[model samples]
Target chain A: MKKYTYTDKKDTRSGFGAGILELGRTNPNVVALTADLAGSLKLEGFIKEFPDRFIQCGISEANMIGVSAGLTIGGKIPFATTFANFATGRVYDQIRQSVAYSGKNVKICASHAGLTLGEDGATHQILEDLGMMKMLPNMTVITPCDYNQTKAATIAIADYQGPVYLRFGRPVIPIFTPADQKFEIGKALMLNEGPDVSIFATGHLVWEAIQAGEKLAEEGIEAEIINIHTIKPLDEEAILTSVRKTRCAVSAEEHQLNGGLGDSIAQTLARNYPAPLEMIGVHDSFGESGTPAQLMQKYGLTADKIVEAAKRAMERRV
Target chain B: METQQLEQIAVQVRRDILRMVHAVNSGHPGGSLGCTDLFVALYFDVLRLKRDDQGKVIFDMDGRDEDLFFLSNGHISPVWYSVLARAGYFPVSELSTFRKIDSRLQGHPATAEHLPGIRIASGSLGQGLSAACGAALAKRLNGDDKHVYVLMGDGEQQEGQVWEAASFAPHHKLGNLTAIIDLNHQQIDGPTDLVMNNRDLGEKYRAFGWNVTDMKGNDLADVLRTLHESKNDSEVPTLILMHTEMGYGVDFMMGSHKWHGVAPNDEQLATALNQLPITISDLKDY
Candidate 1:
């Protein structure tokens, strides 16, 4: 298995902040609008640098979305930031009609996603955001793994035309990817090249997949690991290639098992490769107020869970 | 255009609204009839449209230097379509395609068909003000000095997003945008007061930090003068409370919410046409 290390840990929202600040300096048309959650979204850096370009929407997610859609009319790229719950579920119709159906170039940056959003409980933690946004015709849904990749994605989405839903989390995680790595929208990065089982992971689960790869190596089970960042436009080619070589796959994500990355990969494999796949995610349940570690552990989203799923997939490959 | 010429166009626009809704058998003509004069005045006299080399007004989606208009109360699309065609945005013949399959003139104003006059799709109510503020901010950012106008139904103020947008404009100082509410006091269910009273709407907007004005929307001269006066420079945004009857010109449909979305029958259409007598100088029918 390929080895990986991190010198420091940082939250993905801060990566978004750093990226948008850079975009504010580079792209003249990039504007930021937040629904009274700039500090939580880590957009203070962007606001400090370009105060004129930032708009405080004062707890109105729907209006912020509509305004962002309107800003696209005059060729401005607007990033509407809020919690994942508010960004997707709270103002879904607004995003659907104003931004997605209208084909407006608006970036919906959501922080505090999934079970890791800890202590705020179920009302604030949204597990169905990816499914809701990905269903929209013109929406591109992206959930980067770590800080570096999130920053790269934040900068990359500004240049791409059309609406996008960029999902990131609150907890600080390992920054495994390179700081200057070029982030492609629908491309998967292969972390390990092995023939036993292909492990496809996204968001914060990418690091757990890496850990599973290392443990499987120690147990004489060589696992192939691939990071599937962009959920909507899934890297089908990469997934098919890895699964074709391994004959089995394991999908891991910090979302529900019903309509998330697992469903996408299962659908892809069911149509094309038809391989034995095991998924590790929250199974149609809401999360509670607990520490990030406790919540993730209760939700069965650790390295051991991925390893177990990988073994089950390998065993089921008959 | 002269006031008499504008009034003549408005009569033709009322005729077009009646005919279009009558043809489709499924459209909102009550608010459409009420807002016809306002639409006629804005398109014919208020808006500074882009002209081509041949000195004809060019109708395209881009509204950078030109004044932009959005119909929030999009059920009244018949009036907007008529005024837009009369202002040379498209051919008058397209009015026959209202609510038909594969037609640019949708039941409500939509950008899905790439219509030049519509910038955003708005039938959902209370979203147009946010969109207008966004466009106005864009103009400010692009160094373009132009105004953005949006029209909403009086009952649409009951939507919470309207209050959200109402608070947004003044806080952001989107003075380049103007919002007008057609205060006919009726919606699909019933009278707005019986459905839900907003108390005093002018005071609500004023408390939210907007420069408020009232205008007689059915009166062509009053609409022209009030709209012109409200577009003056100010630090706060402007809201024109336009008052008119639900069915202004037609006596049968007037002062009632029953005709809000109901289409007039053949006999009723004839009665409406008779009441709004068409002139040769009024409209070149499609």
Candidate 2:
């Protein structure tokens, strides 16, 4: 297993905040719009620095989406920020008609995704966002793992001229990725390489996968770990190459089992190379209020769950 | 252009709407006929349109330093397509391709086919005002002093997103944006008041902090004067409640909601064409 360590912990939304600040200074045409969540979205600095460019959309997610789509006409990049639930489910038709179908250059930056939103319960927690956004024809879905990666992804999306859904979370997680890394949109990062089992993870489950890799290595089992940041426009070549070598796979995410990263990887593997696959995610249930650690453990999103799934896949391998 | 000249173009446009819908045997002709005079006044007189060096019209999608218009009530795409062609946005002969397979002129206006003069796709209701607000803000950010115009159906105001956008524009002080509500009092189901009563539209816009005005949409002179007056400097966004008949200028179809989406048949088409004669101009027939 490849050695990985973190010196600090930070929330991914703060990374987005840092990225937008830099983008505001560099790109004059970059504008920010929030659906009454500027403080929660960590957009105060961007709003303060460039007051003229920011628009407080005042709890109107659908209108905010339409406005963002319209902003692209005269060469302005708009970032519409809100929670995951309101961002995807509440205003799906607006995004579908105005942004996705129109192919507008707008960034849908969603925070407080999955159970890691912590104590907000299922009403605020959204596990179906990735699937919903991925189903759209012209949408690129992304969920960066940590602060550094989320920051890099935020800045990188500005240069990409298309509609994108950048999903992040609220909990403060370990920052393991490099600070100055160039965030590639659809490329998978190989964290650890082995031949026994391939572990594909995204968002909060990425770090847990790394921990599982270390634990499996100590037990005389080799595990290959890959971080899938971009869910749609998925790196099929990288996933197939790893699964072909390992012969079995375990997918992990802080989302539902039906339409999360596991579902995506399962479809890709089923089409190309069938293998013994185990998924670690919420199994068709709503989350309740709890601490982030407790919720993750209760929902089977911990390293132990990944390690068990990896072992199960290896055992089922022919 | 003179008011008489604009009225002549509107007559030809009404003929085109009837013929185009009759050709496809499917389209919305009521609102298209009702809003023909307003479209003629804007395209011919009000807008500082894009023109080539020889003063001929040129169609450009990007509206920087130019007045931009959006049709929120996109069911009336026949009328928009007619005025767009008559204003030299595209060849007038393209009007025959309306709603045909693989044609740029979609049943509802769309940007997918790379159609000139269409910036966003808005078949779904209540999205155009928000888009216009975004464009207006973009023009302000780019230091371009231009206006943005959008038209909506009276029944389309029932959509929740329209109210959301309505609340947003006045709060943000979008002075350069003008929204015209086609108060024809008719919709797909029935009369808009019966389907869903929009009580006192002028008062509703006034309460939402808009500069409200009323105009006769079928009258070329009133449309020309009211549209010119609405463009003056103001502290709030402008809303013009244009009162018009459902199927104006057609004696049999006027003042009724039956012709909203149903196209005219052969006999009806001939009767409608006789009502709107081909004036002394070089406009072609499809």
Per prediction, the TM-score for chain B is: 0.97, 0.97
Instruction: Write the residue-wise lDDT of candidate 1 on B1-286 in tens digits.
Output: 8999888888888899888988879999899999988998898899988889986787655578888888887888999998888788888888999999999998888887987678888888788888888888888888888888999999999999999999999999988889999999998899999999978999999999999999999888899888888778566899999999998899999989999999999999999999988853333453
CA-lDDT, candidates in order: 0.91, 0.92
True contacts kept of 2: 0.67
List TM-score (chain A only) for every prediction: 0.99, 0.99
Poorly placed runs, candidate 2 (over 4 Å)? B280-286
Error of 2 at B167 (Å): 1.4
Measured with C-alpha atoms, the lDDT of residue A160 in candidate 1 is 95
Question: Which docking class does model 2 fall in?
Answer: medium
Span of 10 residues, lowest total lDDT, candidate 1 chain A:
A95-104
Please give, for residues B171-219, the per-residue lDDT of candidate 2 as tens digits: 9888889999999999989988899999999999999999999999989
Tell how far residue B181 is off in model 1, in angstroms.
0.6
lDDT accuracy of residue B75 in candidate 1:
84
Model 1 residue B127 lDDT score: 86
The global Cα lDDT (0 to 1) of model 1 is: 0.91
